[model samples]
Every structure is written in structure tokens, then in C-alpha cells.
Target chain A: MSQIKPKSIRQVRAQWDGLFWTTMSVFGVFYLALIIAMLVADFRFTNWSDMTSLLSDARVRFSIWLSLISCTIAAILSLWVAIPTGFLLARLGSESMTQRLGQRSPGCRRLFNWARYFIDTLLDIPIVLPPLVVGISLLVLFQTPVGRWFDQRTGDLFASLGYAGIRGITYEIPAVILAQFTVAAAFAIRTMRNTFEQIDDRPERVAITLGASHYQAFSLVALPQAWRGIVAAFTLAWARSLGEFGPILIFAGTARMKTEVLSTTVYLNFQFGNLRGAVSASLILVTLAIIVLVLTRLITLGGSSNKGVIV
Target chain B: MISVQQLLLRQGDFELSQISFEIPSNAYAILMGATGSGKTTLLESICGLRAIAGGKILMDGDEITRTPPAQRQIGYVPQDSSLFPTMKVHRQIAFGMEVRGFSQTERNQRVEELASSLEITAILDRYPRRLSGGERQRVALARALSFRPRLLCLDEPLSALDGDTRNNLTKLLKKIQQSESVTVLHITHNLEEGIQLGTDHFRLEKGQVRAVVGKDQGGKNTA
Candidate 1:
């Protein structure tokens, strides 16, 4: 390792510091300018009459509502599966558990390592695989014998609840929700896993010695401290779901008033040579996505003040 | 009374072999060792927090070597106090009781009693982040003492405090031991603490642990 002399207090601002900031900021602005320039182009492309006409359509209203409702639902459902999965992943190799299990045979430890690898691979699928592939995968699953059996029972249950008109996920509206969940849940898990990792395990161990079972300690001591993280994960997942076009389009198909969310609405309009309607719909989604991203940043800022579960 | 016989623990590159000690009922036993000599590891083993490859740990004439921490009836206070930052002092102290199924009235009364004894009655409503180091230690102590465990395992309980705070807490530890008549296994690197408080002295040297006397018990050369 090369040892560099420490700079004097008077020379705190070095030549390298100025060059570093200038180079990084230029690169940052280059990426940021792309989004700003594209939005500006959208504004220039569509006229006031075209924008007004697009918004007046019943299909546009339904698409916006569908996107908002489905994304929010997917976000909430993702947390239910994500929290425990994230917690387990975050706490897997903590000192207490590892040391306690140190006496186990070599085969057991190796198996434990493999189990962790398997879980991580499973979690990475929706994120690493293309959105269209996720859609195709779900579509392919429904054609299998076991998948068909489960869908038949589920379809009957939905029919009993008067959602027969909605169609029982023969690649229908519910497929939009399934597709969003597949992708959004991976984001939720990543967010929550990082959140849980930030909390110290000492307090949880202390709670255990104080007569709390593992579940009680986690729920009472650990979970309460992760409140901000839960909100962040949900919102980020919802925001990610809002931009899901390829998956929902392939899995659910872009039928207006049925499976037409904002992203798909833009695609459908563009396919039909309705460029004004496409641009208008795209701008609305872009605006909504920017708002969701800003909200995520604000929530993160609010959470930064909390000191976690340890003093 | 608590007893450890031929305890063997291995963690990564470090190993403790054939370590043994006994602390009679209500006795204050101090275990002294250098930084990496396995004093804390042994304490954790007694508390069932660490896996022991070969050993027998008996508390009050019953073998509890493999028992889980929650069922071991051992109160532990780590080096930094490890108080839950999200909780108020009152709730932190009452948590053990809550877990042990104590009623609200019982929990409140016990918290009041421990807080008064530990001289932290004024800061009961404050969070751990708001409390000073001494105050946090007091809350950790109150919490550990909440369920009235038969054995108390303290890992350098006063190591983090300043000189004045250390003296005050040392006095409080003595006072609590006298009042509660609880068996204690305290690990410390301080000689003054061992001499001032211990009725029995054990020291770990080159991964082997045995009892020692007076002036040389906590010395660096003992390792």
C-alpha cells in the first residue's frame, strides 16, 4: 500500500477534490438532462386540443385508475411476503446464531449455506429476468396441469364472489396484478433486507435474555424500529409497479377498460397510429412516476432522523 | 449456586479447553482475563448464548447447559448496556416482566422498585438515546433484574463509564447484590473492580481458566 502524506489544514481543498466534483457532477447532469429533455419533447409534440381530447376518453380514466389501484394493492401484498423473508436473510449469519450453531456437523453448515444461496437466486429471478419473460413465465405456468387444477378452483371461488365477469386470470386483469407483484416484490425484499440489516442484533438478543421468545423480540423490539423501512419498501415497490409495461402487456394483454393501465395505454395508442394520445398518456405516467420518486425521497429523509433499535 | 465443569468451546481460530469454575449461592465471583482470553465467551456459554462442545453448566443444582436463553433464568448485561433505543426507560425495564406474563400492576410496581434502587426514577419516561451512559446502564440493569433471574452474568458492566460514573455504578452493583442476594459472574479487565467486589476470583490464561487470589488475579501477565 502506498502511504500519502496527510494534507495540512490550510490546504484542505485539494486540486483533486475540485476535479472529482466537476467530473462527477457533469456525468450526473448528463443522465438527468435526458429525462428533462424527453419530458420537454413530450410537451412540444402534443397540442392543447390533443391533450384535452386524450384525457376526455373513458379508457384513459380507467387506465389511470387501474394503474394506481393495482400498483397500490401489489405494494401492500409484497410486504406481507417480504418482511419475514428479508428479516431471515438479514439475520442469517449473525454472530449469535452462527456461534450457537457452530457445533453442528459440517454437512449441516454446508446445507445451510446452500439454502441461503437458493433463496438469493429465487429472489433475483424477477429482477434479473426481463419483464416480458416474467409475463411469459406466468402465462406458461397456467398451461401446466397443476397450474390448471389450482386455477380451476380459484376461478370457481372468484365466480362465487361475482368476479366471473372479470375473467379468472386466463391472462386477464388479475394477471396485471400478478405480474406487478413478481417484479415489485423483489424490490420490496431488497429494500426491507437492507433496512433490517441496518438494525443491530444486540437489542434483539437482549430482549431474548429478558424472557422474550424470538418472535416476541422481533415483533416488539425489532419490527417497531423498522416502521420507516416498511413504508419506504411499499412505496418503492408501488412506484416500480407503475412503470411495468412489457410484463402486463404480454401477460394481461392491452384491452382498454379491462387490463389497460397507463403504461399499456400508451403502448396501445402508439400501436393504433394515435401518436398524440400515446404522447399524452406517456406524459401523465412520467409525471406520476416523478411524483412517486419524490415522495420516496421525502419518506427516506423523514426516516433518516430515527436512530434505529440501539441507543 | 452456579457451576461449570470441563467446558470446551471453539470459535473460528480461538478455542477454550477444559475451563471450569463454581460460584456458590449469592456469591460475587469475578473472572479476569486479557482481551482475547474467552472471559466473555464463557459468560455467554453459561447464559446458553454460545455453543459449548463439551461441558456441564449447573445453576442451583440443576443442569442447564443446553437450555435456551429465555428459559435459562439468567440476567445478562453486556459491555455497552445494549438498551433498546426505541423504548422509554419504564418500558425497557418492564419488558422482561411483560415477556414473563406479569400483570400491568406488578410490572409497574417492579419498575418503580428497580428504578428507585438504581437511582433512575427521574428518567423513566425518556428514550435510551436521550439518556446518558450511566443512565443507560442503570436501565439495562433494571431490565436484567426485572424478572429476578437466579444468576446474573455481567460482561464488563462498568467498562464504558467515566471514572466518577464507574465508582457510582460499582457501588450500585454492590448494593444490588447485597439486596437481591443473586449469584453473580462478572467479567472485567479492571483489578480494582475484582478486589473491591469479588468473594471468589477466577482468571483465564492461555485459554485455560482457574481461580486465583488477591493482587495478581487481574494482572496482564496472568494471560
Candidate 2:
């Protein structure tokens, strides 16, 4: 008997497959094209010769520098928190902590479940709640005694260091980083948690069996494999911090040449009816975002050769 | 010698209870079980990777029920070769010794010796991804045996190899076991291979254990 599919059957399958892919390609490619068109149109209306001077403007430069510095610092801190937190969440005994606690007592199990539920819900609050809500929450937090005490201690240290640029910890560079971290770290945590969850725990276990301690196993087996995911997480957090506006504006007041970041510069320019300046700043922001996005893609693609531990 | 008494473990819905066994020092014991019979679970428990509910694991006269896997000094090769992809073969073999605070010269000497014996000396610089399945298994074996573990746990070590490769490796493994005299807890579905190597035979069914065959001091079947 002939093994090949019948010509009529093949034709029918090909026809349906072609139609499905064509429909998918039409909408998918067009939406992406529209965004590209709009961005290109923004450039088309601009004067190329004046672009350099627009970017080199003192206020613009200061805003960009501030945004860069703050976002970088925030992202570093976010990763520091995210890596460990994400791993902990991912490794929290897939047997269910609540179920394991059942061995203790029924009441303790209930408490464990509630605690787990509360923590999980809290993780997504930054992403689920409105950005402005995060800003308002931070403002409300700093008014409390605990926050005031922390602020005073940090403020005292900075004041003693003779830094005239910083006023108080609440309305300065530190506040900017904190505001950015609150939101960016949430995204990074989700990313890294998913990464760790996807990875099999067998290699780490094997490492431990081979005379490596808990920390050694994690460092040797888990961390090395998690490098790509960590890079991706950092890229996302940094990009998100760059675009964060509400929390920074609400928590850290935009003081010109002090706390004024790029996002606030765009807002202030638009408010002052400096349409040209606003558009210019937005374009710069878009360009920077694109660079970061492209860099992440390249890094992911380049590191695709190593598939991590087999299990 | 390693001994397990009244071991109980629950993983999700599966319950392995009242498991008991003893493998004498420098003896090869084969644990035979069907699919989902909790053989791997028992091996992991022995290595201190699994949480046992009520049990005692005595190693060389020391009660190590709560010992960490690192302190247990039990080398484990899981069913699938889970070689760390980022490391070279040498690094994988040396990882144990490095973590155990062995000096550079000792680590290098042991790694090279194991690599040569395992026929992976040429591929020591190669990453796990570049190796063949059989080669990966050999590297895993080298890594497991590098630190001179008190007991070696092989979780279906030959399951992934071809007939010829499996036969050759079985002979090689037999030779290594004889020379090292490290207590072995070998899990396998291959009955013939088990009978060939095992000084003691144990069967696990529905999470329960039975002494199918026991061997005497002279390695003769006394079941």
C-alpha cells in the first residue's frame, strides 16, 4: 500500500492551515506595524538637526541621568530581593505547606493556609492595584511612626554626610529608588519565580547528595542555571522602573534639578504647554526602552545554547 | 553498613510505610520494583533528600535519621542523568571534593583518576549538553564516586543505555564495586542484571518491602 497521504486530503488540510495562518498573520503583523508607524511618525515630524540639541538640553540631561541612576539602583535592589524570594516561593514544598502543617494540628494547618494565601495575594498587589494607589500607600506609610523613625535615621545619616542635594529620605533620590522598587520588584519576583518553577530541582538535590551543603547546592547548581533568567528579570525591572511615573510623582515630589526624573520631566513639560519638549522627552524615553528591550532579546537568544541541568 | 527501620514517608497521595532493610558493608543489594512502586522514593529517603515520617537510618553505627544529605556521604545517581549543564565534566566530578574542603591537588588527582577510569578523561573539558547519553552516565558515575561516598545509590543507572553499552557498563560497574567495596543499593527493572550483581534481593510492591532473596557472607544465595 502507498504510504503517502491522498492528494485531496492533503489539499484540504493545506487549505485550512493556510487560511488559519493567514488570519493570524494579518492581525498580529498589523498591530505591530501600527505601533511602529506611530513611533516613526513621531520622528518624521521632528527636525533631525535639532534632535541633538533637544537631547543635550541641561534639564533634559539631568532628568535622564536621574532616571538612569535611580532606575539602575532600584533594579539592583529589586533583583537582590526577587532572586531569593522567588526561589523560596517556588521551592515552598509543592506538597503544600498547609498540607504538611496538617501533621502538627488542624488549627495550625488553617493558620498556615491563611498565611500562604495572604502572602500570595500581597505579592500581586503592586501589579493589580493602580499605580497611583501605590504612591498614596507609600505616602500614608511614611506618616506612621515606624516609617517616620526609619526616615529620620536615614535622613540624619545623609545630612551628616554633607550631601546638600538630599533634603529628606522621603522626597529625594532614595525615595525615587524605593518607589520604583515597589513596582519593579513585583514584576521581577513573578518572572524569577516562574523561571525557578520551570527548572527541575533534581540537580540541586544531586548536588546535595554529593557532599554539597544546601547553600553550596543552590550556588553550584541552581544559580548558574538561573543566570539567564536573572538577566531577563533585571532587564524587565529596569525597563519598568524607567517608565514608572505615578508612584514616583506621588511618593517622591518632583523638585527641579533634585528629584525631577525623566517621567516627571515629560509630565511637567506637557503641563507647561511645552508640546515640543514633551514629545521630545517621550521619544527619548521610547528609544531607551527599545534599546533595553532589544538587549534582553539578544541576551536571551545568545544564551539559548545552554539548556541547564537535565533531569 | 546502612540500616533502615520502620521507615514511613508520604508524598502527596502516595504513602510508603513500614519500610525496613539492611545492606551490609561492602555488599551489593538490588531493590526490584515495578513502575510507581516507590523505589526512587526510598533511594532518595536513604540519601536524606526525602522527609521520612517515622524512621531511623543508621550508617556505620551512627544514627543519621536527621542528617543532611551532605553529611550523610551517600552518593546518589538519579534515574535520569541530571548533570549540571553549565559545568565541564571535570568540574562536575570535582564539585563534591571542592565542597568537602579538599585541596586543589587532591581534587585534581581524584578527578583525573576517576575520569581515566570511567573513560571520560578525553571529555573532561566538555559540557554535559555535548555528551552522549552513555557518556553522560559515565560522567555521572565519576561525579558520584569522586568523593569516596560511604554508600552509592544507583537509581536505574543502566535504564537509559543501549544493550551493548549497558552490558559493557554493567561489567565495568561490577569491577568498580568489587575494587571499591562501597555498599551499593541498586534499583533496577532488569531482573537478570539484578540476579547477576545482587548479594541480596529485595522486592517492593505497593510501597511494601519483602525480602525476596538473601545472600550469605560468601556471596551465595540463601533465600
lDDT of 1 by residue, A191-278 (tens): 7888888888889998888889999989999998887788788887888899998789788898879999999988989999999899
C-alpha DockQ of every model: 0.70, 0.59
Error of model 2, residue A203, in angstroms:
0.7
Chain B, model 2, TM-score against the native? 0.94
Over the stretch B176-211, how does candidate 1's per-residue lDDT look in tens digits?
998988988999989999888898888888988877
**How does residue A276 of candidate 1 score in lDDT?**
89
Full-model lDDT for every candidate: 0.86, 0.84
- Write one digit per residue (lDDT tens) for candidate 2, span A1-311: 86866998989999999999999999999999999999987787666554676677887789899999998999999999999988888777444332344335457566766876688779989989898999999989999999899888888888899975675668888889999999999999988887777777788889988988778877788888887789888988999999999999999988888788889988998899876677778888898998988777767765554332110
Instruction: Chain B TM-score per candidate, please.
Output: 0.96, 0.94
Minimal lDDT window, size 10, model 1 chain A:
A302-311
Interface CA root-mean-square deviation for model 2? 2.5
Among residues 3 or more apart in sequence or in different chains, the pairs in candidate 2 whose N, CA or C atoms overlap within 3 Å are: none
